[model samples]
Target chain A: MPSRAIQENFRFLVLEVTKQIESTVQVVTTGDEALIDSVYLKDDYIDNLRGFIDAKCLTVIRDADEGDERTVELARAVDIVTNNLERMADFAVNILRQYKYVKDHAILRGYGLEPLFAEVLGALGKVSEAIFKADVNEALEICRSEFNLDEMYAERFHRVMSELRAGGEQVEDLVTTLFIVRYLERMGDSLLNIGEAIISLALHERLKIHQYWALEETLDVGRGEAKGLSLESIFETRSGCRIGRVRDHREGAEGNLVLFKEGQRDKLLEERAGILFWQERFPDLVPKILSWHEGEHHASLLLEYLSGQTFQQILLEGTSDELRAALQALGTTLRAIWEATRVDEPVQPGFLGQIAKRLRDVKKVHPGFGDDDQTIGALRVPAFADLLRRAEAIEAELPAPFSTFIHGDFNVDNIIFDPAQDRLHFIDLHRSRRFDYVQDVSVFMVSNFRLPVLETTIRRRLSAVILAVYRFVQTFAQEAGDTTFEARLTLGMVRSFTTSTRFVLDPSFARAMYLRARYLLERLLAHEGGDWSTFSMPTNVLRY
Target chain B: MASDNHEFRHESLEDRTSIAKYLNALSEAFANGNLTFGHNGHAIELEPRGLLKFDVKATRKRGAVKVSIRLNWQEDEEDRDPSVGSLVISTSGEGK
Candidate 1:
């Protein structure tokens, strides 16, 4: 069979690379120039073997049975594996060459070099399982090996640079050692590429190596004591946090699923604080934080995975009754939380400032959309920057009449709905805070409107949801005598719609949103120093 | 997801003679499973086939009258990349 042929050739290629690595390590450590012959001798064999494997890959893919998905995936994976392995073998040769330049061959031994070799070799050992068995945990270990190798290289590199800077007689040795460490770091990078390729093939989706490592480490630290765990990448946020859902297959841990999130330290800490705030106020409304961990400059959290579908899912695929139920549940939760945590103090959210922070990203996507001040016969329109400046000033003067603890993101996806329990749960609490409730209300409306599905039916559902949330919140505002709610909501919408265009590339759709944002800015600019309560938000702008 | 999108749009008033000619051309293009629209020195090509969603809405409010027509269909992505943006929309199931 083509598969058997490909596997056998691949096995031979791997063996050749392994031998090359082993021989290189042996010569570098023993300080024996004669041993370098074997390393050089094997280089030709490794290169030829890689070429052979590459040729076989083309053959199998071209001649295999049609629609043989397994063969196709395996072939593609082998293609990636051999390419990285060849580069790694080349790096090993590069190291052997650099080793000869050092005045003292023994000098390489002084800088924790053995363990770094071990880490690289150890990663190669797992390459088999990563490719053949398609073991995710094995792939995770392989990827983490690079991070470990980097730490080792960093320490040695610092000493080498420092010694060279000191202008010592051992400069040759230190500089050569510097070149050698760089090769080791390159080997680690190849290992990462090989591991991620296997993982992408195994999962039928591309998974980044660091993201895989993050998920594994979070599981290891938090509720990861349970064995036989499987991970699936769910979503990643613009904030660069890797989000995944994990299922525990350990005995008695069946159906135990949790979400693992890892990102910059401050972001995760903020999320932890948000969760704690909700837990104290209404525990059931937010996902319970299972565990939290921080190291270096990053943090990870294991959150109890609510089985409920997100509100976005309900709008797309749920029955009418289910949609209504979720909407009703969400409304009730918002009302109760607002009433319970309402603080009678004025608070300015800097919604326009928030837009300014992301304006660069928006410009990155829609470069020509940013406008300069323009004039008609009887009118002058301010530039986007000038409008934002005015809006910021206006926002400072017209703070929300009251403050309440609110979902900082308030996206449709962050809110989960459990049909079985008829409960609503929130996730990604990093942005949760005591802000103007209008911020949450406006975010929810725009999130619904921004969903890319544009079939008429879903659009109607989105419009209905936005309207329902608007009327519901408007009633709450009127009851609380929050007369400035409309004025603030328009500004909030301006922030969301303007910034959200970055995520969408549909030109017509993006322009619609950008134009609406500009129109709102104009309207807001036109109403300067007016009675804030008299300012009414044109709700149709929130409609799809 | 990395988005590579093309767009075509135009806004102008037209007489029935021009409107009829433009729409007749559009109908022919749609029937041929290929449509290209141009505006302001830019053009976009679209492929429409199989079942399509058609929508129309109209309103006559104040001193203005408006009408909108929308067409929707799925693109054929036989070799769609599994990894795009982080967002994945899927129905709830047993497990991955």
Candidate 2:
């Protein structure tokens, strides 16, 4: 038996311990993607949280020095909380173990947005600084002005994605850009959150308290248009060089910015080397490559320095219909790539092409192969015999077309809309490939309408938009005597035919893609005078 | 870590729920000589000390209890010596 007051104190301590545990866990959970994924890091965070809980519990017990019986009861309560808190830590650690990156460095040479990313990070840093300093006007100005860099980057990104889609470059580059852009966007969101939190805290009149300022901003500028370096030849330095004090202007932009790492310099040099190679192969790709000296490395082609609002930066500022316009611009930009693209290299016995080959082999081995769960599960639609059959049938009707570069990565944020010129500029063309039109279509569709949150109707409308743009682009390619576009389109159509049900039935992104496919097919049928519905795709294809 | 010389006694006071009325009754009883100290050989007072210790020792007994306690004391040098205390009882049944 214990006194009522001692019992009440014991219960109050238990509740406080619980509250502290909850708050600490919340703090530990909030962070970047890497922090959220790893079991080891998550476990460490949980353990740290539990340790705090233990300290709080100990404090409660020590402060409440009641008689022996009451002290004993409180001590027991502390032990109970300690045990349960430890268990919660274990659960958090288990969550992080699933996402591990295997590669030391994946090639990202193709998505050439070094300049754009540099500006993005710079703008983000300035905004964060303004928010930290409580300069609301500066914060708003940075938010408004950050989109100006989009024009340069978006065009570069589009060109790169186009090249990759056309199978002109490696798929590895495309994968890297996907991760890079996703992270960059997320980083932008984090900065916004920090700014909002600061504003909220200030409104409570608790401003300028508990400031621990240590935020890092990094950007890498690669190759041409930014060559030559000297502390003194400062004005001679180019846009890609690190911003710093001016020294001289005799030598071209080379080895100048002392702030930049040697690795960054090497990367820029690599880009220069790559540009030389590109110029040698495709002389007309850039208008008359300029040469400071008569060497391949010395040649420079000056592209228009783009400084306009990006669709993302614009959307962030909340001007309505801007995002849709940006999306449409992205779609149009991809359509342009689809119109002029072809595979520069043969499908080099790679995984995707191999799968297509295997589909052919498997069909030969088992002519009566039925779509059993095992068979369906093992099959990729593009590699299926039926899809290849449709592609072969469609290919015979189109003339052989030359392959032009296509951008493999096409997303809205990579587009820069210049209202003055009424033109959209694309950026990051490192992953420029010479592949089929379908590759471009897939990239565009996945990037544009692959959102997890889109409703069915909107998804359908978006699908329609994609197919319409795809067909329009393919037709243009056809008119230009580029039959590869038609071939690519045929392959894509065959794929759609074989896996229409699977596309439609996907529990996840299916409904969206299905609607888009339906819209595209309907338009395609109307124009081509052949009903895709009458083609009779089997129901077994809906294995997904 | 309080002053070791402070004296404390474990008194077997009556379990009183009604303090005022019961105290008054006890006072009247004491005045009327109905209650007496150590009545019917009952011990009500005890001596207390810091770090209370208890031990048992066996000794030869004559036709009764089989064991007896060997009590010892250690007092602070500046303090008065502590009073030694113990309780002794014999089994009711005779040892064969």
Candidate 3:
């Protein structure tokens, strides 16, 4: 009978073999076959050693039956090798099956690999348990039987390979299957090696010496690595904390006033910058960051308190025009932030990728009026392709503009008002991205404004006002010689922005929006009679 | 339970204490609660010290008007840092 230590060795060998087979098959089945084929045998020095142990385990069991002194020594040797092999082979069969599944599908497996390997390893564990039992002399005999298994596997492999050689075109399926068969054969060979090692341990006093050295190194290496921490410090600190605070002046005013924490420092300094910037641009924004220390955890701002009821609260009491005016104010605040950022630059770092990503995310709403989810009545409009054309024409007619900084997120919440001052201030400056002028305007139209209240007519008029302001801002940029581009590239970039969002909006609305937008764009394009592709703008118009 | 002179001194201290309490409550309520003046001049300004006191004045062209009020001593950091606190309020006011 095998010792506990030998049983553990057998278990490890079985599990390791199981993992290798499963991972290999998972790769072939999952369309990661090339990746698996590249690394499958890179670390398989132990297979031969396991084969030797399985062969020897039989010897030890036989010696025990004969009551020889060699039986005890053989058991100890089997203990080490069998334990290692069992652990390796436990997932072997499932891994082969996974490869088979991947080959049959002839496609890349959609799921990730980690879970597949885990499940296979879990199932192969039962075989390892059988090896560890003291009374299982009969179970140890299986190790002696796998020399015959290898012959069967080799024959199957040859037959499949021969069939593949005779196959015609459309061989992806056949080739995939053949690859699966090869992985399956290798898996059988690994398991057979384990069985042979178990048998060998039963017959001899010592198992393969080469396996012990490698196993020791592998185990030591695995144990020496440090593990990652379970939680990040920021998340841990904020777990139960709520936003906003109230301080009692008389009881403890002194401690709360001097800001010291790191988060507070960044927050306060940012707030100071925000206040100064707002004072320069739009003075109406309230809760002004008065002064902030870079050392404080949060920014300190002076707030001009708002006393009026919220728009939602006053909905019943207000007239439609007042509601429209309030919403228009929100729209204006959003546009102000966009206008301040010089988004017309092309080569600014982080500009291209962000624009491209945003372009990709905008919905591809159907342009037809009859679609079930149409937002606007059917309006025949040029496809995104045509919009690109019109944009190109405009670009050719216009001068190339340099890129400028733009408010990255021009949303409703950033707007603040003080009726006393009749002022509007925009806050939350951290999302400053550089892109084309239209990027800010388009995103504001889609994200900030509601569908029903903002029809194409309103958007068109608002966009005109925004464009007029943009034109004024662009003059400053233009004098700086930054707004230069060939008409075509400008059109392409603008088209990309509009189409990107058009893809995401409801089909009917998208069509109406796109048609109206194109009408405005065509007016710009017609103003410039030349083709857009022939135009060019200076690249170095905006600098960091 | 005290002498007449002692009692008189105690009453004087009580008046000062009451004033502090009253002013603190008024200042706090003005900052936090929704107390709208009918016109521009109705407003409250609070100083940073522990005392609770306020000056209610008329907006642009209006005269100062008497108003009914209630006060509570809620606090806010006069600035952003949590270390300092200024009384805030959950107070109410009615125009006369």
Candidate 4:
């Protein structure tokens, strides 16, 4: 039923969305204000195109002959594709708008988003090719390549979340980064839909691309068994994986099974291998890997569903006693993990490298902060760049301590605590490795303190927990005679305070954090003979 | 979108003195009820007789500040004195 004009318009819409994607990629990678502004300008044009397509599609559908199923179906497909392309363009505009915030803040350089833009642009390019050529093979490639985007999204999302949990400053920028990646992932999803629609038109058969892929994975269970297995959609990961709980009604599986489809055999196998490794070492800590399937086109892992509340949930609703208990248990678990993973060899602490990177990010976001007389809140802070340079020089004189195994992402949210069984479980352990134990300790302390609640009671309780953990860690460091403990902790605090800038949008909270970091840097500079142990942490550092 | 009856002119001035000179020339034309200007052999003339509308605006963004002044008036109508609104100016210690 669609006319030639409508078809041409739809093609043009696809091309325009692709162009928008290209421009967004450029803006994100290069931080070009002109490109960002141009994207904003194109928004009106994209909206107008969407309106024109909708009108044309409606006219075609109304004018179609009675009982003309093919024409009607074709018109519907065009309408769906047009709607998706328009949404994709809207997301492109959203990315640019967020980029303005990034530019204003100047946290551009170390986000590692350029590679993601490249991947998304590449995926979008293939989608455009598939749509233009009406090539089924190209369309299939787009569908298959979605897993790559999902993988990248998951990696970036988890990393940012970890940094946030660890008190990485630039919270605003990191959160924006998360949204931008999410938009890119959604754009990829729409592109996949467009690719599927093209394939459907070319083959003259309706195909739901995602559903087809899901069915393909489910059918591997055997056709007869697949029919009885019902999948309820849970949520999609940022990395584009379709995750759901599958249950066999006929067999009455004891627990709901989690389904993970990466659409690639090797990647899924790698994940399965990692899960198995954790299951072997920490049997009670991770979910059980029940079964896995690897097909020619896709791979999936079925994991046992662990029933309990995540630590994030408990933190919100749990009483002070419950929180204290959780923190105590958390400290014990961390000690166990550290004991299991600590190495005899001492390596240089990456304080200078880490602080230098964050300082650069801060400079990027608040270039004016480099001025010595810049006032943050009621406090006059020295040039941030100069302070960082001083901190680097001070760090050069300190000793590097032994490394320990740590949950690289020690955010409470990733932890699951079963009070009834008195057990602690961990998820999203992809970043687990041998690193500074302070990484976990600092993240735990900050995560507790960073909860959105502002009530005096809640703040006091959270502060108490932070103090308890700090004292516990300090005791351990003293018992072990780790003289560099204070310096390492100071560095961790610096990372936390500066990175808090990204997360806390409130001007007062941000200024408090900036002033806190400035105070610590001043102390580090004033301390003679590099004796970090004598450097006292201000009691009011966490006041805000 | 081309019009034969419409004429437009543009010029950039180096400083306030040059801007004042241009404003003086335009003010004299308005006072005489006849406006004329020539540049690069292109010239225009008009007889103005109407109440004029004046606008003033100031804006600051992204480190740049701009203040714009504009005047618009109709042609071939009886002249009338421009109406003035109540004006109250206050200065703060903070410099603009």
Candidate 5:
């Protein structure tokens, strides 16, 4: 809480519009025409005030240092709140004009507008208080107002449809009546925008309504109390999920925390299932799922945040001994899981198919990767598209002799190392499935290869790490009598190397990955064999 | 190590006058059948042969404007395959 108050004009603008909304309710209550016209005229004043506040916000932001996140976020929230307030005022004037179209107020009663108007008024009152006082609970109430408006509109809409279907008279009046509720819905959306801006102001991070709800729900479920607990979002993923860590910040509340994730329903479902699977088998090897909830199209997963450094942190920052210890622990975990969960089912990994699915994304990022077939005197350079068909032919015969529970996207970042406990944990398990262990192996190798560390010493360390894992997995394969492990690994590496490029933006790095794919495809095309065991992945190719 | 590799690459946003100047130079080069492009210690000189490929493309989609002009021709002294198809990586554990 900054002892210095927020700028007065922004507060004044929001409060002024909120007062107008209350007065509009009064007009709707008393059916006063002159008062309605005054509400309509006051909308222009709100618009001008919005402009003044917007410029003042920009000036405040421009004057603040870039590192002053608090000042910048405050200015941004004020700007967003003012804009949404102006929109609500505009919607108010629109409703007043449209209400005149209904000649007979009796026929206009679908579900009634009084309840909708009252909710908007309630939500608008909170916006001024939420922004000025930095009240998160009040902001949440404003968000719930949007939800309430939706329910009222849904009921009204259902009745309107029935009346229209009945082929009754006064269709124009019925439709205009619906438009009034629609305007209410629009005003509700503005309130949501204003509420979210204030919530973002309080948390110092911007959040969507679903993400805010996810955090609130997770907190409530985790400890049966969400009041007085502040939220801080760690990051928002490209998938539009919220990943945050929650803490009990009370005086005696020390070191009790949980990782909160809210994402697409299907993704969180997969993650919950994966965590349960790992819990049933190796309890300490993955995070404990504390709570889970699904709302609308999104889901929230609350897990005890594991206490350790990720393999990524070890590789990038820790000592060489730490890296080696992490790798060895990872190898041990893989061996245990593979041995325990290995199923006797011959599975073709469809590595080429995986590459094919992601080709569009790859070309979307690096358009030049979509190469054309070239003829150079005596040589035929098949296009990348042509290479896939040829490689799929080789991939057809080589299937792993068994399937195991594997992390579908097993990169270094997902694996956590707790040196104190000498244990490994997995997070981000949305992609877990019963598949060939080679998929995890290939991703591990490519992940180590493509670490973005160009320093000579660290690059060598990555190569060594890749080699160590490859040897460990290869020994496991040999003992399991998976004869075609090397061949399947070749195809798997090609799939990983190619699809991984789409996620990277550095041109040279993407090129390196794309060329490796091309090189592997060329190798597959050149090989003539039904004996898959003779095929081997080149260690040199994986070095860089 | 004389090779038939002539490379000229550029990427930037050119204003109207700058583009006109570049186009005029290209037009004169086309008339003379010779073009030289030089920048930052990298340079290339080319002379058109019997057959030349000219490709022009303009795209306006997805909030982007792209214009490309390409001219290519085979060199007279080109007798090699001009392919790295013989590239082979050893599977042996040399690092071991």
Candidate 6:
């Protein structure tokens, strides 16, 4: 039997899970809308109870006398079991929410989930008993019962998909049912994790849970002829891409290979194509694509790893002289790329169209965005709709500029600079295309200023680099006479700052960027009745 | 009686001119130490007292922005309440 503290918390957790499961069953069986609120409320209570049990278990383990290893193991098992129980409760809530999507569908009312629900409840009860009593045999039985739940989920999933594919009018209903069954399967998986934790406690052996199975699969080096390979995750993005370093066992072949995995296949293919294009044309500046694997469910690419710190790291750690050198190199590299890809024919500028579309997107996400006083502090900034109107008017009066193959996402973090080799390498070329050079320039400058740090010294250093790059680009293009430079740059800044809100999650960061975008819009409106050519860039552009 | 204790009343005014007028009225009431606001059949009355606590907060998230100003005061009692601590004010940059 477990200790008093473990047994007490386990009893509370079991009670909470039982309540959650009952509410979920009520929602599915009775279609009682009021019970849905109870389900969510109970889920919240279960979450709090889980936190309390977790703290109590930690206290038990910490306050245990020396040489009390058995108590520590029991406490750890209780912690793991309670956590899984909480997750199971969450999945129950998810099932209820998904059920709402199909509740009104006529086809779903006759479909029965009673047997599967009964089996899941039985398994949950057995697991709870196993945890509270430290019954290894019962926990093992729960593990065996998971296979049945998986089979039921698969059978139901296939039936739902077949119905969906048959092109019935209730396709939405079928899809929601599919998700509901999937959540039930995931709940079974959570129970299996709890079962494994119990077995580990009884046997006094550490066992790896299923969630770490993917890492274990990746570490399995038996598939290839390459020997002694090590994998380390280096970066992850919101798009679910995981980039890792693959080092070889051989002395010379190590640290030269990078692996990109776990993102959309088409995006990975596009990145591979982009890298190949640049590798062929600008051999010194792009990593060479080694090999690619496009499997049924997973896609990945292997590329040569470039050695150096990113431009962001350089800016943060390098000396002023080093920063200036890096900026000059960046300018020179951009000039080369532009010169090579510049098209003689001028295309109608798409600046206004892009800005208009982004404004609509932001407004769609937040209907009452610009009406709040906190948006621009004390300033009376125009609404996004008004800004779009002014931008349209301004675009009509401006001449079309030349188009070049510009890096669509030319942020500092995407560029790597090897000071030893005096070469710059580019990554994340997914957005590369032919566009206005000012877009790249604006993104680079704004990205630098958007660093979280706001020290005056760092700001001055960054401002110097931005001004130097601006001067270099202007002189290179001989665009001093070009009337559209300042106006286009301002519009680019507006686009950059506004669209950045989609990526930033922190409230203050989002507000600051929104205010900056509004500030640019205010500047643009100030020149509404004046000459567009004579409008100068703001001196405070890079100061922030 | 429990339902009545839990009753809530809310009114929203969006027009700038009308909101300004309402604000002026509220300002006058604060100066007079009593305020009563009502719309349609629902209304609330508040009496101002010594030592009002004021809070101003601004928040932006997921493309939406909000600024809230709240004032609160406690009714005087003969026995001191331990739960009521010293009033504290903290401020940060509007956009930081």
Candidate 4 chain A: 10-residue stretch with minimal lDDT: A218-227
Scanning candidate 2 chain A in windows of ten residues, the lowest lDDT window is: A209-218
Model 3, A356-375: lDDT tens per residue?
35443453244332122212
Spell out the clash pairs found in candidate 1: A271-A430, B1-B85
lDDT of 5 by residue, B44-70 (tens): 777775445455678999989887878
TM-score of chain B of each: 0.67, 0.23, 0.22, 0.58, 0.63, 0.58
**TM-scores, all models, native as reference:** 0.70, 0.30, 0.28, 0.49, 0.74, 0.52
Candidate 4 lDDT over residue span A1-544, tens digit each = 4677876777677778778888877766666668777777887898898889889878778888898866766776677777877888998898777776773334545656666667656656665456545566667666655666777789988988998898855788888888888887887787677767865654455555654455445435532234345555445554455556655554555435555444456656655665665676678878777666667767666676666677777767786556655665666776666557667667665655766666666656654444555554487656866787777767676654668766655666778887776677776565666567877776666676666778855665665666667776777777667777777777677667776466566665666566667777766677857457676555445433
Fnat, 2 decimals, each candidate: 0.00, 0.00, 0.00, 0.00, 0.00, 0.00
lDDT of 5 by residue, A79-152 (tens): 88888888888887887787778766677653567798889888876776788777887888898899999999
Q: Sort by lDDT, best first.
A: 1, 5, 6, 4, 3, 2
- The clash count of every prediction, one per candidate, is 2, 59, 139, 16, 0, 0
Candidate 2 accuracy as TM-score: 0.30
Interface RMSD of structure candidate 6 (Å)? 22.1
For model 3, residues B1-96, the per-residue Cα lDDT tens digits are 111221111123345567787557646665674332222543333323222222223344376543334322212322423432211111122101
**DockQ, all models:** 0.02, 0.00, 0.01, 0.01, 0.02, 0.01
Clashing pairs in 5: none
RMSD from true fold, candidate 5: 12.0
Q: Is the docking of candidate 4 incorrect, acceptable, medium or high quality?
A: incorrect
On TM-score, the candidate that comes out on top is 5
- Candidate 3 C-alpha error for residue A513, in Å: 2.0
Show where candidate 3 strays beyond 4 Å.
Answer: A1-356, A363-383, A386-408, A433-506, A518-544, B1-96
Root-mean-square deviation (CA) per prediction: 12.6, 39.6, 26.9, 27.9, 12.0, 19.5
Worst 10 residues of 6 chain A by lDDT: A207-216
Ranking by DockQ: 1, 5, 6, 3, 4, 2
Q: lDDT (CA) for every model shown?
A: 0.80, 0.38, 0.40, 0.66, 0.78, 0.69
